[model samples]
Target: METKAISLGRSLSVPFVQELAKKGLISVPPRYVHTDQDPPIISLDSSSPQVPVIDMQRLLYEDFMDSELQKLDQACREWGFFQLINHEISSKLVGKVKLETEEFFTMPMEEKSKYVQQGDLEGYGNMFVLS
Candidate 1:
């Protein structure tokens, strides 16, 4: 009798998302379907206000600590999110990260589906689904 070894990195025969997209189906998947009240996608003005930019450099200073903290608090309280500035991460590194991210997202769905989650986990995912 011959014995065969199972490969951990082997992928499924077909990618589920690619197959669904090829069929022209665009409904939200089970994970994204909200059972609660519908959030407004737009207001009467339909304009997206600018996000607050919180400067980390100022937050680290003694004189600006309280003021920056208050600004951060206000941003969260009002906007639910804010853009972080002067985070100290190098610009070159940030650019590299952005480039790599674009590359990853541009890959063919069939190639990416190789990383689909199994019983426990897989590669990168939005916190909404991965969590």
Candidate 2:
């Protein structure tokens, strides 16, 4: 039996930043740099903006569940991502994953292109853009 391939949307092929950096250019390509857009939120105070952190331990408790869930929602809405703390995953396993990901990225462009996002959501290229 054959498995069906899945695709979220089509994405335009773009050069990798690693390839661009290899050129040793002093300035980034204008297309790669955005000069016009300002951040959506600006703080008057000097404190720097921070990514929200969602504590898994707190989420597990009845007393903290509601508040923690709200934090998770706010994190997704405002920051798009958040740090997950007290997850208790094996550090060794996390390290291995990190190493493997680094190794994959270090692979030559030709080798990496084998997993190219060919009109699919699951591959190596950009994920959100649709053509």
Candidate 3:
């Protein structure tokens, strides 16, 4: 099979081999050329809207934790979710709980079954089902 060596810059235009040959850039050589079926078209018009920003600087500076709590409560009552800035919780405890929950769920079926509640009991009671 005969192969043609085409120039890089000439490849952008259609009939590149013929044009290159006519320009004395490359010899007229027999080769199998595959044209692009369809180049991919990307649309940048589609995008997600940004989330709303809530400012809590005044509440923090004034030491109005109660007012902030009330605001959070109101937000929960109105909007299901709200961004909080100056809230504090024990990271170690949160990490421990998360790790424990992950480990608990990943345990063997028999082992997980042992932790399952057969009846409603206090301390380890199913809070969701209860009043």
What are the RMSDs of all candidates, in order? 9.5, 4.2, 27.6
Instruction: Give a tens-digit lDDT track for model 2, residues 17-130.
Output: 899899997887766665675555666765867769999999999999999999999999878899998999999989999999999999999999999876666688787643
Better of 1 and 2 by TM-score: 2
Off by over 4 Å in 3: 1-63, 75-90, 118-131
Candidate 1 per-residue C-alpha lDDT over 1-131 given as tens digits, one digit per residue, 9 for 90 to 100: 99875435533343245456777876856644567755645645547556788999999999999999998999998778899999999999999999998987778776776765563334643222431
Report lDDT (CA) for all predictions: 0.71, 0.84, 0.51
Error of 2 at 104 (Å): 1.1
Q: Could you say which candidate leads in TM-score?
A: 2
lDDT value, residue 70 of candidate 1: 97
Of the pair 1 and 2, which is ahead by lDDT? Answer: 2
Q: Write the per-residue lDDT of candidate 3 for residues 1-131, one digit (tens) a residue.
A: 99875432312112323335556754344332224434333555546322233446646656765776677677777555777553465778778998998887666555765664433332221323311
Leading candidate by lDDT: 2
lDDT of 3 at 110: 55
The candidate 2 region of ten consecutive residues with least summed lDDT is: 32-41
